[model samples]
Target: MTTPFGLSSTATTNTLVLGQKDLEIIQPPDDAISCLKFSPLSIPQTYLIASSWANDIRCWEIQSNGQSVAKAIQKHDAPILSCCWSEDGSKVFTAGCDKTAKMWDLQANTFVQIAAHDQPIRTIHYIQRPSYSCVMTGSWDRTVKFWDTRQATPLKQLALSERIYAADVFGPMAVITTADRNIQVYSLDQGPTEYKKIESLLKYQHRCVSIFTDKSKNPNGFAVGSIEGRVAIMYVETANPSVDNFTFKCHRSTPQPPTNTQDIFAVNDIAFHPIHGTLATVGSDGRYSFWDKDDRTKLKTSDVIND
Candidate 1:
């Protein structure tokens, strides 16, 4: 079976290679899992962290034998919508329905809090440079805010036209997709002032965004997914720009029996393998797919997780 590490396993005793029942499974939270992220690639051992709508957060160390043991878990007052790790893996940032963003000490289990928005936060991300680190958040409030590690107040908050549905950062550039079907890009170094809005269609509501970072220090393009099962592979016009911007259909829905209509589902998440630049996407259909972006090809699609 294909392990999550992007490798095949020949070992018969590997639990991750076994059926779901054979693997070490953490007790699931009462609600849906909202986000899942791995520990920093620089770390010796990989850890999988998951936050859920049950107002719970948990982390588990991924064992070499494909098993896992819980390392930490905490319960909050409200459901957590998203979570991300700090640059050094020393802190975990979580945002939720409570309209607050919190920084948790990974080892100590203590936390500091910030009132981030008037509406529930939908996403949170952290990126660091040699000189400074920043945590960014996107909210249903139709705003994206950036906070420097040293300050409690946001350095800047940019007003988005519609509710922020998805946002992502790669190096100095970031992309924000809103409810109005606007896909906007920003320069992290330029704070909230420098941004460009891409002119796209009004058909699909963006569900997720991911930036490509393998080839260049500052990659020019990003991929965004929509509720209609399409993915937009967009390139900016400057560093400043590029010409190969396009969008395609992927993770399509199935037609209902005796009806022309099909069940539409949201693309839940998108990520590029750090080393390979291969893109992976997960959808509400419970299927996961792989794409070779450089080749503009669909590499493979897995059966629904339940199957």
Candidate 2:
């Protein structure tokens, strides 16, 4: 199928064209790929990490030819739902239905179950900066917990009213999405001592499905996506003494279609471009569109991926 924006190709290519283009899909192992993270270092040798619904974590080396070939890595009994590479790309962290978040030593090719979450862990991220090296996790248990990777127990757990679907660590703040249709932003800089909820925005019926911060624009601000096909730009406002001061502006809305207008169909994943200030969203409808901050117009729409 072809659209006005660009053509969709199923061919696998080792090279990325100067402009936006489709990546060849190298059939991932078995089961569905639940999460994907690319090494921040370089392209080929950098590595792409994928966690699966099949209780597996696989690392594929970006070959010299730009092709991805899966490397056998750690295997677990429960599905690996979410995974992330450390800031320095030295380690990998994964959370899963096994109810634990494990750390992988890339250099040693070993796995260590670092912290156990009460429920199926949905997301895990490592916070590394000038002052600390810690891990944060959000779970179906309706809570977010911070753990000192060096310790056996969690440093702090913030109770919530809904199950957490996803979370991201940015600088000193952590942005979390809940099943209750709220995006809860928390401060990681406060450590375990005291955590005041930074911001809570109620905007959807199916939870904030995805959230991504623009690494190039306002690295501190982020965009939230919900199941109902709505995305809002959320920014942290720390001036207020209590948390939850963060505010949001609706950036894009899935068109109540048949209107001959293009919009996000149903956001499944979102990523900020490597250089541009554009935010890319991939949806269940296989539409890939890029948008700017002001939400003025859909900047670009490229190839669509049909599942």
Candidate 3:
């Protein structure tokens, strides 16, 4: 069978699902994937990096014809929890249960430990600015640290209300969620000070978050997902009565013939489209959905995946 992208199912064992236009990698991680990110748009080639519970990170270059070629692999002593690519797409950073974060340089082909925490690192993000560039890491240690990567110690560290659960950074804005249901917004322009602190709108534990821009492409607000199968669209400035925040239910299955209750699955991750500003979410129900946040409507929902 031949795919629309010119890939054949029988030609290579590295690819799969010819009819649906899905192509599986040759050898995936042994355990569950913790995080995945693509290279910055400035990069000409499409490169993907994935971290896993198998205690390793893998990179692949996706070709123009839909073929995927293995590029690089790096390892940690413990399971990795998060990973991100540098703004220039020249480097990758990963954090994990090993209590440390590592930087992988694609040009030099070197992997080195760049930061450490008292407890397992939960999430990491790369922040690039005109004056400086740094990696921001959140940990179960109840703190967020900013690292220069070249230094042995962090340049700045801020205490949080509780252990970090999820976080995201876009431009100069950063949003962090903790185990105690606290959400703190930060303006990196002010040197990492707390800009606003609020409780999560969801009733359960925070699972994921992503910062998004408004029509002007300015950092306006963010979307948060929770274990209760709900998501909240939040604005940085709630003082304006015209801009409102809202929550909605998703990743839930309909009741069967005999039962009146639905099965609710945790929302695992949320991402914003770079060009369109639309939102995308993936849940434990093995389904993904796209939404127009501005209109408060669901654009599309995918069928549940078997795998």
Question: For each candidate, C-alpha RMSD in Å?
Answer: 5.9, 8.0, 4.7
Query: Across residues 93-143, which tens digit of lDDT does each residue of candidate 2 receive?
Result: 999999999988776677898888778998888887576778888899997
Worst 10 residues of 1 by lDDT: 5-14
Candidate 3 on 1-307: residue-level lDDT in tens?
5432233333334556535777887567999999999889988889888999999998877777777766768899999999999998989999999999999988777899999999999999999877778999999999999999889999999999899999999888999999998999998875677899866678899999999997788898899999988999988876852458889899999877776789999999999998898999999999999998888999999888776
lDDT of each: 0.78, 0.67, 0.88
lDDT of 1: 0.78
TM-score of 3: 0.92
Q: Write the residue-wise lDDT of candidate 1 on 72-93 in tens digits.
A: 6766689998998886777788
Clashing pairs in 2: 198-244, 199-244
Q: How close is candidate 1 to the true structure, as a TM-score?
A: 0.86
Better of 1 and 3 by TM-score: 3
- In terms of TM-score, which candidate is stronger, 2 or 3? 3
Write the candidate numbers in order of decreasing TM-score.
3, 1, 2
Most accurate candidate by lDDT: 3
Estimate the overall C-alpha local distance difference test score of candidate 2.
0.67
Compare the candidates by TM-score and give the number of the best one: 3
Clash count per candidate: 3, 2, 0
Q: What is candidate 3's CA lDDT for residue 14?
A: 54
**Winner on TM-score (1 vs 2):** 1
